[model samples]
Target: MTANAADKSLQAEVNALPWFHQIDFGNGVLSPGWIKKSKVERVSRTLFDPLNVTGKTVLDIGCWDGAYSVEATRRGARRVLATDHFAWSEQCWGDRRSFELTRQHLAPSIEVMDIDVPNLSTTTVGTHDIVLFLGVFYHLRHPFETLERVAAMATECLVLETHLMRLPFTTEPHMRFYPNDELHNDHTNWWSPNRACVEAMLRDVGFKRITMKHPDYRRRRGIFHAWR
Candidate 1:
């Protein structure tokens, strides 16, 4: 079978799973099956669509359920590492089962690690050709520092997806910060960041090429790609 045909078959299998049809993002109740399938589809399209992934090493930070890791492996990544804080709560299993299932489904190519994000070092999870940091910045207290650390681990590309603050030209309400709190919590639904601030931060972290994507000009939300 052709490579494209194989990929389509894999994608179809993932989408056909029952969990993919039921995910409650508003309530933060993600079906691990759905999250894994959707992330595989999105990351595969975004990162692997233009470039060849064979023999490349990919790192997925804050990988909730090995979704991106699975897709990277399927796309020919030689090695893929999935890391997350795995901070479990009463409501969530912290994606433990999903990671294990993904590992069982795809062997050798993907490795799952439960580690604290702030303590990430070269000794723990080595550098990679591509790094994915998705839906994590808003929750971090030191977001710029986090980006710097993630950049240090990426040899080629970094894909970041987060909530952005509306700029002055945009017709969106300013987000209010909690007293003495630089981080967003369950109480705070969103912590929007201005484009200028994010650009400056990325520059400071040694990212040369940067591209931003948003649903609209209103700057309600966005994703960014930074290359070293």
Candidate 2:
């Protein structure tokens, strides 16, 4: 991995694809991505600082570009499995090349699967000590049913990051539905659940305890740490 290769061959490959997570290849080569390098680094801290993953197995669902998956390996996780489908498929704007390219440079030992949200099961993917369900909740058509499946795959904890719906006047469990691309400009964006709704869903899915925080100053995003 020389500077010349990073500047020429690797950089060209990175430039050819769409990237979700901005990543540093540690050789002065960086992926020009939608999620900037600084933001991803900040989110990484917000995600990992509250807990430890050293020597633990982690499963990352919707692991586009493998940012968190690679970070788990960097934090000394015993094993990591990064999975995705829409973000890697032809239907989406991105491709699997970004994730593969990042893993080739950053964390080669990490496993990967082209698994969709509905197909996740302990029998298929095996349960993990820590499961990362980041930025995938609202995109699903069946958030509650999917939570049950996701919960079944977490042996200890589930870290869920999602776009939140603010119903400031009420504490009731409620989710707002986006019939079109009204939430974001993307059609994949479907539902946004408020704090109470998400917490309640986590409880119904078998988590003994749940905590949520908004890393950003904006009230529309949240990260839920659920312990089983």
Candidate 3:
């Protein structure tokens, strides 16, 4: 088939949708996503090394626009499952159109689901060699329960990224709760835990090995690698 009117129509459809991740859709076209920072820039290269997952099953929780999902496939993961609920719900500025379109263009074999974190289990989503739980932890109302649930499905490793709080004088397990839209003017932003607290939670949930990948004190963000 030749590139014609149908192709242009499809490209137009993709451009019209609201995107969160900067997804490139070939032929010099790019989805003008809202997020300023690139996923690769935030996650970084060294972080991707320990979570190599070559020929291993990979799961990307809260996979908005399937950026990491496509990255996992690029790393030669045997199977990549991208799961999302909030962003894909088609409300607010989020919709599954970007993810669906991105997957169609890149990493066509990637599987996607609209499952929440609490419902994740061996029976529901099966087990994965590696799970990417990036930028979703603080949003959970039941942090412990959700972390435990995610831990159960990971056979090898879980790479996590979330907001952190630095007390400056104390190294205690503390988490600031936002009952309203106090955090970044968004109501979905619920909890912000300190670095020690995050590590403790991972240990409590049955991770044998825990490593802090990136701890940005200036930005107040943390990246942790937990091994099952």
Winning model by TM-score: 2
How does each model score on TM-score?
Answer: 0.72, 0.96, 0.90
How big is the positional error of residue 30 in model 3, measured in Å on the Cα after superposition? Answer: 1.3
Residue-pair clashes, model 3: 0
* Models ranked on TM-score: 2, 3, 1
Q: Candidate 3: list runs displaced more than 4 Å.
A: 1-11, 37-39, 42-46, 215-218
lDDT of candidates 1 onward, in order? 0.65, 0.90, 0.83
The lowest-lDDT stretch of 10 consecutive residues in candidate 1 is 20-29
Q: Where is model 1 more than 4 Å wrong at Cα?
A: 1-44, 87-93, 170-185, 188-190, 215-219
Tens-digit lDDT track of model 1 for 108-137: 558878787788866789999888887777
Instruction: Give the true-structure RMSD of model 3.
Output: 2.4
Q: Clashes per prediction? A: 2, 0, 0
Query: 1 or 2, which is superior by lDDT?
Result: 2
Model 3: per-residue Cα lDDT over 1-228, one tens digit each = 467666677668878888888766666567777653354545645457777778999989999898778888888999999999888775556888789988998899999999877788778888899988888998999988888888888899988889887667888788899999988899988999988899899999889888885533335877889987
Error of 1 at 83 (Å): 0.3
